[model samples]
Target: MKNFDTDVAVVGAGLIGSATALALRQRGVAVVMLERDLGGSRASGVNFGGVRRQGRSPAQLHLAARAHPIWADLKAKIGIDGEYVRSGHIKLARSQADLTALAAYAARVADFDLGLEILEGRAFRERYPCFGPEIIGGSFCPGDGQANPRLVAAAYAQAARQAGCEVIERCPVTGITREGDGFLLRCGDAVAVRARRLVNAAGAWGAGIAAALGDDIPMRFDYPTILVTEPLPPIVSVNIGIEGGGFYGRQVERGNLVMGGGFGVASGDGASRPDSGALARIGGRAAAILPATRHARVIRIWAGIEGYTADKNPFIGESANVPGLFHAFGFSGGGFQIAPAVGEVLCELICEGRSSTPVEAFRPDRFQQQSAEPGRTP
Candidate 1:
């Protein structure tokens, strides 16, 4: 059996894992990243790439606020463009009720210094005429934007590699065993990895990893479908989303509009593809938001499996049942934007034995209290 040793063993080379590995290596921690497929081939590489804090849950605002600066300087730190653009993010409201919700949300996050601008009626139309007449008002966050999901995870993994981190692609961890204050990770029956610390950044497969270590987190897999239209003249300047999550879309520099809504189907083993019927519904909604999209030819449509926790918040920080093991997963669909900050947080937890950010609400054992109840697992 082939054996290797490292200070940290990170499973799943998605954005979170790659970012964590990169951060750990930068701190001089010997790190090894194991990927089931090519790094970032899953949800991390195939997400909507909205790097916004406007529509996040209250629990996520703190992390999102901390992540914003990191994202702003991502290109400089990663040595790649990653197509990150701070073109701003606008969430439209179709009715007075939706507008009220936006106002309440803006008020709630005011203390966080988000500076959300609320626009209505003539002001909204004059600033953003790309929308259909149905849009009544909107909330805009100038600092929030979008990035290229296809480029980010792989870029972090490559950067980690250049910084002396070992990244093992196509290596699926089949079993894990405790070994003298460390972990013995078995990939198939041949390769073995012994590490003093472990990070479960497995995205949709994270629940299983947590369960293996005796922490049964309630996580569900969701397959969100995304559609890309052929390049058109730039019309939508800001990343757009409708209140209530009816639809969301953004135009890249290449002029193609990437949009997504609704869920698709996935196989038992987690292989997923876009649902034609769902894609049709998404296309109709996209055209409704921007009529020009009705004429734009769709060039690609795909789906990826992402984990969603019961409360729609991620599980971060160390495990309660196991020592020297940490978890960061179940961002629902928002992990891509805050992944870099999460990596930094993980590094702090591992290296300094605590995080500077207030991550108490994201503890891995939060679900344990809910799971203790009979016939229900939150």
Candidate 2:
């Protein structure tokens, strides 16, 4: 067995894991990244790639805003051309109920001066001519945007390597055991390795890692299905999301529409791959907002096992019981957009035990009451 050494071990080379490793490396922490598969091929790649602020829970919105610049910085530094479309986003409201909710959100965000506005029927038509005439009113956030999720992950992985991070692919971690101030991580094919700090960035499979370390947070696998349409003209001007969050999407640089938002059909294990029937069910919902897509031919469909916590928020902090272990998953389909910022802040927390953003809201220990009894396994 080959021995490995690093300041931190990040399990899972998807967006969260790679981004966290890159963030740690940026902060001068020697990081080693392990991935079960090639990087950026699943959740990181399957997502719709909307770098958005709309419909995000308040805490997540703040993180999204902060992460925006990090995305820009990444694009510039990596030169991967993540197909960023900062053309802004519009959450369309087809029914009066949807309009009312948009209004409430606009009022709620007024204090932040995020420049959110309600575009009435005529105004909405003027701004977005492609939207069906049935559109009532909508909310628009100028700063919200979109990017290629795959490219973003790839950029970070390459950048992390260039910055001296050791990335080991096909190194699926079989187990993680707590030692004195670190962990003995068991991976396939390779011998166990030790690290001073361990990061649980293993989306979907993160909860298992936490359980192994005698820590438990409410995290489960949720399948969010997605599909890409045949390439066409730039039909969508802005990132679009319909009511209730089941259908959301953006137009890619290839001019094909990428659609996803939860409630997708089961693909591979349903537990692992995106579903097709679910994607079709959601496509019907997507067509509800954009009636023009009714006849659009869907070229492909896919599924991704996203991390879903009991409360729908991510578990993004240190374990109350484990001193050197940290968690940054349970994003519930929202990881792609804010991954960079999440990584940056997580690096600070793991290396220095503090972050610029007050992450009290995302603390995993908050669910301690939900964990099993004192004698029970976490």
Candidate 3:
């Protein structure tokens, strides 16, 4: 029954939502952060939390390199322990094709001067003895790192709250209606939150929120599960053992290995349960790359759904047809690293009506125009 009239209303209090709220508040904007449940209770709490730049497309790598510093800045500004470890990232090569891919990716980033090295064969083994005999070379990005995703979400929510933003927990937005140069968010059971502008940060359920506002966002949600192994002696320096779409994991500060890949057991729609079989299969690959993992028991497994757009980018900025409606979804799996920059960009768009960063790469209209009339030119 809380009636809120603010400068901005942000739906979904995950990393992006919370960060956007914090940014807007920093600029003296009145922000209301609405969470269906609580912040970080979903994917924000469940992701691998790897703030990495390696293995990213050229565009993403450039943005991540910039976003890395913003994370540190946020950590320092908020005094929140998001576990901002600036550990280097490594992508191991189990096959020749993997080696080639790493080499090509290295060449691509040469312009950014990312300080990476291509280690191969015996040299790679000499650098990392923990891997199995079948191991090959690897590409290492010294600047990449990892952070606790849950901690980031918490810090943003707290900072936003401290900066005069209203954070509403357990409020699911039932619908959105447009007002003059603003919008009103309909919570269930006659509850409503109003604001001059509205941001859609619903993550996996973001597309539904868009539709609720009579705007159809072309995106889907896919849930993936990952598991962690019991702490073992530090066998690998950084995360290792990945190929094709298959992935490996990095060892965390707690000494446990957090692992996941593009490959996993297919759970039904909106599934959030962890699947041991998927972990077992991924663990088999981990053992194949580094035999030592076989001895480590899997302690826990978890799952969270992430948004995927028709294009491989995100959907930031105001919706094309819906005035005062903003969306920050469609990050695919690369949201963790670029989230800070995404927040910064979104904050600029919300405050100044545009961002310095080239948001054209992540525009919501990108998907809509893909199937438009041939000469309609986006």
For this target, which candidate reaches the highest lDDT against the unseen true structure?
1
TM-scores for all candidates: the values are: 0.96, 0.92, 0.92
Runs in model 1 lying further than 4 Å from the true structure: 371-378
C-alpha lDDT of candidate 1 relative to the true structure: 0.88
lDDT of 1 by residue, 122-176 (tens): 9998988888878888999998899988888789888888888888898899999
Residues 115-158 of candidate 3 have per-residue lDDT tens digits of: 87988877888888877777687888877777777777777777
lDDT of each: 0.88, 0.77, 0.77
Relative to the unseen true structure, what is the C-alpha lDDT of residue 360 in candidate 3, on a scale of 0 to 100?
A: 69
The C-alpha stretches of model 2 lying farther than 4 A from their native spots are 262-271, 274-276, 371-378
Tell me the spans in candidate 3 whose CA falls farther than 4 Å from its real position: 262-271, 369-378
Residues 1-378 of candidate 2 have per-residue lDDT tens digits of: 777877899888887888788777777888888887777776887687888877777777767777878777665655576877677888888789988999898887765556787888777787777776567778888888888777777777787888888888877888777777788888855757789888888887787788888776766566667788888777776888765666777887787888876554334432445555676677776676666677888988766777776666788988889888888888887888888788888888987779888678899888787742222111
- lDDT score at residue 99, model 2, on the 0-100 scale: 88
Error of 2 at 191 (Å): 3.0
Better of 1 and 3 by lDDT: 1
